[model samples]
Target: MVDRNSPIPIYYQLKLHFKQQMKSGLLQPGDRLPTEMKLCRQLGISRAPVRQALTELAREGFIYRRPGQGTFVAPESAARLSQRTTIRILTYYDVLWMASLEQAVHHWNFSHPEQEVDLTVTMCPRSEFHQVLRRAVAKGEAPDMVPLDYVWITNYARAGYIVPLDTLDALWTRILREDLEPVVAHHNTVDGKLYGLPTQADVTGMWYRRDWFAKEGLTPPETWDAWLALLDHFSSPGMRQRWGHRYAGAFPIGTAAGEATLNLLLPFVWVAGGELLDEKGNLALDTPALRRALRFLQQITLERRAALPPQMASYRWWNICRLLGRGITPMTLGGTYEWPRIREESEWTDEADAVAHLGFVPVPRPSLDAPPVSSLGGTSWVILQQSPAREVCLEILKLVVLPENLAAFCGDGLQISAYRSLNRRLATTPEHPWLAKVIPLLSLARSRPLLSDYPQVSRFLQKMLEQVLWVGAPLEETVRQTAQALALLLEY
Candidate 1:
């Protein structure tokens, strides 16, 4: 309700009211709000206050006005900011980040009564994080605290977008505990400096259906042949969810473009005993390993017939979720975030078991001699060069990365705990059942190559993958074409 008597402006009060409703479950994504006429009738306010409220809400991204559909609630990401000085969190959208970040912000506010950290949302796609982050820092409007994916820390570090954590040396040291192998810590660093703190993690996996497996008399796949047999068994043209695999739908599935493509492609790469990247992260795209990886997905999605829904040709990460949720497909190739939704029934039944029927494992490599691999997924926290409270903000990162709080994040949402000490804690979430299978799989977790030209590479790969997947091109020919394009991009 608008507090007409409060010193705060009525429209802003209304905006906050809507925001709180969103946060508290009073409203939901895509839910519609009252029309101007209806709002005036209910509030006993004139068109003036009602219109003002609508304008403010729309500006804050709380509501979207359709030509004839009236105003509807935007995704929570849209309305989470309003410009005050709370710890502004501009990163990928994840509930785990919210749970822990809000807690950290609360602690910061409580610990320092004199200072305030107002938070805002800058919901960005995974691939866009570094680009937007650098732009924000260059413009002096960077988020006070921004989470990044560790694979790209060096790229951002190279751009001078990250603030040093050395100012919070002791606290930083605790956050990056020695218990974690220096190799793991190395991902969140650049040039021997810890510029960011990794939070949760996921690697690539073949998310499949336990129900389907049991019904079809299949076991969890252990080799490329077993995986192929399962695909052959489940794939039929008329079944609603044929052969069941989905790719990245909301964000691009692979990062490092081809570097990230390994997450999706590595199972095949490893199975064939191929190495896709050398130690320095150059594409070994022509190797038998690379050929096997490309051929596997190409066959799964097209030739062998166990593929994403016909529509998934255009799917990104979220689209995969939506398609799976809607029962268009049964299996997915995705991150561990699916744990929260896997057991619950889809819209068909209020039960998650009926809906998602979830199971995930690192897809088997070609042979036992080769270790199965999955790419790490999820985001991390980084300091911003442009923050006014750069020093204090680094302190907040220390606070957020603490085990107790980070575990709390891992327990709730898509966030995977990043610290080594917290891995066991994260393993205990009986609530996130799919996680039981998810964590052991993390041992094979490798990150996408930390390429400097990631965005360009990602764009090119997406374009090329679409070309190969959609245009019916031969994998070998496609690789050569991709190599040529990449060579051109590198030359420039």
Candidate 2:
């Protein structure tokens, strides 16, 4: 309480006093302010000053306004510059993400027992995530943090729904000490600022059936020729007449149109020594390397009739797991994201068969003195420019990103931590049996291109690639046209 007789104006005094209370840890985040009536009676100030201070606080996001409900303390986000009194996070997939967050937040609550942070999850139909995203931004109801993929983020970042995290890396890594992956530091950065922090990362890689490979007396393919030979063995006339290379019934598998379609195709291309865009932002798909890459892709689709299961085209990353979970595709290309979902999820089909049939390996490449390559992909938690609780929001984020905390998100949530230190530890965890192989696989991965107009470039490239494989267009023609379209959208 402050004296009205002080030289400062009544409202000014009140504002300063309340500000001190908040900043001094006397009023932590989510601790509601005294009601106007209570403040008026306590301070012996009239309603005018009390209301003015409350209005000012609400405007500044010190408190939130509700139509019928009283004001509340702001909630948390990446940086809640304006507090999130009520944040509804609409996640499209990755079920484990929230649970990990909840656990982290729970621990945070234990440390700050007086404060509260509420997080609500609404499962937006995966297909409508984009539409809903636009609506949320337009309506000023955007979530504080989200599980965004690589492709849509650049546009969203440009659109202001995502806020840049320019100074969090060192602090964030210290907080997560052992949980963040090495490449994660570089993967989620947009223009040198970290945009998202993944609890886990899953890039495209070859997932083969151990039993199938062993039964056929074949090792994981290493070179392009070896891969083709494996395909040839599976597609041989006698084998085709039988149950597709000794399997009772299973089909060849491939990547689908995912959140980042290029993650699937580009690694294969890069391993073959292709570069999609040059430093000058020029779009050139006419490279011999690109041609060779397409030739390999075409071989997979046309020669072996290798296709993603019909259901996968529309499914988010998890559906590919379902296709794998069934014995329908014994050999597929997926990452750790699908690990939990693929563990014998089928009910009508052979559940035991699927569980035992599943296995993973880095996408084998022809090591013709070419630098090994893969697609680096991950997601991160970003602050919204509009948040009011920016400081506390970061505190909560750091808490969630702790090394011990991050493991639950990765091993439990099926994600990859962005901290290199943590990632190395995760790779060594005996519990994650595949981490040894998975870490090496990640060495060659590069994040999908960072273009200003990524959405348009993505759509155009996806259409051209699909046309090349599904509709029989010439690879050169598809590349030329797609490059032209890309140049129009991305040549900045």
Model 2 residue 79 CA deviation in Å: 28
All candidates: CA RMSD in angstroms? 9.8, 16.0
Candidate 2: misplaced stretches above 4 Å?
A: 1-85, 150-154, 166-182, 235-256, 306-316, 344-358, 366-368, 413-416
lDDT by residue (180-287, candidate 1, tens digit) is 534457677666677777667767777666676677676667776776666555455444344343421112233323334434654556657765467667765667
| lDDT comparing candidate 2 with the true structure | 0.60
What is the Å distance of residue 167 in model 1 from its true position? 3.9
lDDT of 2 by residue, 125-218 (tens): 5456678877877887776777777555666777767766555445654444334455665556556556665666666777776776777677
Question: Model-by-model lDDT, in order?
Answer: 0.61, 0.60
